[model samples]
Target: MTKTVVMILFIAACVALGALSGAGNQPGEWYQSLNKPFFNPPSWIFAPVWTFLYILIGVALSATWYDENNGRRLVLFAIQAALNLLWSPVFFGLQSPALGLVVIIPLLVSILMFIAASWRENRAAAWLFLPYALWVAFATLLNLSIVLLN
Candidate 1:
């Protein structure tokens, strides 16, 4: 397959997997009852924001896909992706914001590590992860706040 085709597939897969992960682990009454911070965004904001971020993440992954020396980068990407998918289950499915904090902190670190690893080799990939890093950082703070508030 062509590089463009592979990239498109990667993007689609990221979005699809993310959507699937979220679909089954929605924040129900338990989440609604929790005391959220003042800055918690409306529920409507999450879908679009996550979709955009996933596309960026997919692009970053595609950028590094063909790298000959991508072992470390790939590991970082996988670690972050796994942690990202794991958060919803821990936070919403299990209704444990404290456990979510545990997952998200490492997730944020893995994202930063991915960005740093990509910096010298593929600046585009690193730049792509910047938003993901920022969003996850915000999410980490949000998770921490939720844990503290409740």
Candidate 2:
């Protein structure tokens, strides 16, 4: 029971960190004024999608943390998390799609590295990160499109 609770809290912390990052860097008027691709999702879509993704990330992290031989994997997780934390600020806060691209490319790579590393520790962890990887890949494309358009 205690272990379960610890897991839950750990996961919650990861989710919370992502949420906090988003909250701190809101898509304000600066974001709204920018020209986006036609395929850009409605503003309403991001919250729920990120919420779900963060949960998956949290679970993946917990699984990786508990796995044996997870030292390198955990480092990957931390690197990815740092990259994740930087995206909103660079993209939204700084209001630079070009810079967003800079940050997200690395963020995407870190996520891939984390996913690949996770596979060595836990398959489920790797699986859990797939959606995140996909999302970031799509986001990278979106960012690229924006940089080109605007």
Candidate 3:
């Protein structure tokens, strides 16, 4: 397959997997009853934001995939992806914001690590993760808030 095709596949797979992870682990009454911070965004915003971020993440992954020297980058990508997928289940499915904090803190670190690892080799890939990093930072704060409030 062509590189373009492979990149597209990566993006599609990322978006699909992210959607699937979120679909089964939605916030029900338990989440609604929790005391949220005033800065909490409306529920509708998460899907679109995550979709956009996943697209960036997929592109970053694809960008690094072809590079033989990117083993560390790939590993960081996988770690962050796994952590990302685990967050919803811990936070919403199990209704444990404290556990979610445990997952997200490292997730944010891995994302930053990925950006740092990719910076010299593939600047675009690192740049792509900038928003993801910022978002995760915000999410970490939000998760911490939820944990403290309740």
Candidate 4:
């Protein structure tokens, strides 16, 4: 397949997975009842922020996928993405902030590893992941706060 085709596929894959996860785990009454932290962002912010991040991550992964040395980085990216997908189900579907924290911590670490591995092969790819890392870091804290408060 052509590089462009592969890139588009990656983008589609990320968006599809995100949409499916979001659909499966809608934040309804269970989430509304939880005691959120003072710093918790308004619910409206999540969609836009997540949309942007997922796009960045999709591009980053596409860039890294073409690199010959991307095996480990791609593996890390897949692991992190799987963990990312898992978080919504565990936290929202199952209604367990504590489990979310458990999943997110490793997700953050895998993201860091992915960034570090991608840096050597493609700096742009690594740079694309910075915001994702920061967001997950913030999310980890948010998940922690939720667990603590509730």
Whose lDDT is greatest here? 3
What lDDT would each prediction earn against the true structure? 0.95, 0.88, 0.96, 0.91
What is candidate 3's local distance difference test score? 0.96
Per-residue alpha-carbon lDDT of model 3 for 1-150, expressed as tens digits? 988999999999999999999998999999999999999999999999999999998999889999879989999999999999999999999999999999999999999999999999999999999999999999999999999999
lDDT of 1 by residue, 65-91 (tens): 988799999999999999999999999
TM-score of each: 0.99, 0.95, 0.99, 0.96
Off by over 4 Å in 1: none
**lDDT comparing candidate 1 with the true structure:** 0.95
Ranking by lDDT: 3, 1, 4, 2
Residue clash pairs of candidate 3: none
Expressed as tens digits, the lDDT of each residue in 70-125 for candidate 4 is 78888899899999999999999999899889999999999999988887789999
Clashing pairs in 4: none
On the 0 to 100 scale, the lDDT of residue 21 in model 1 is 93
Question: What are the runs in model 4 whose C-alpha is more than 4 Å off?
Answer: none
**How well does candidate 1 score on lDDT at residue 45?**
96
Residue-wise C-alpha lDDT for candidate 2, range 1-150, written one tens digit per residue: 566776788779977988899999999998888888999999898888998998888888777767888999888888888888998999998888999899999989988988887776688999999999999999999999999988
The lowest-lDDT stretch of 10 consecutive residues in candidate 1 is 59-68
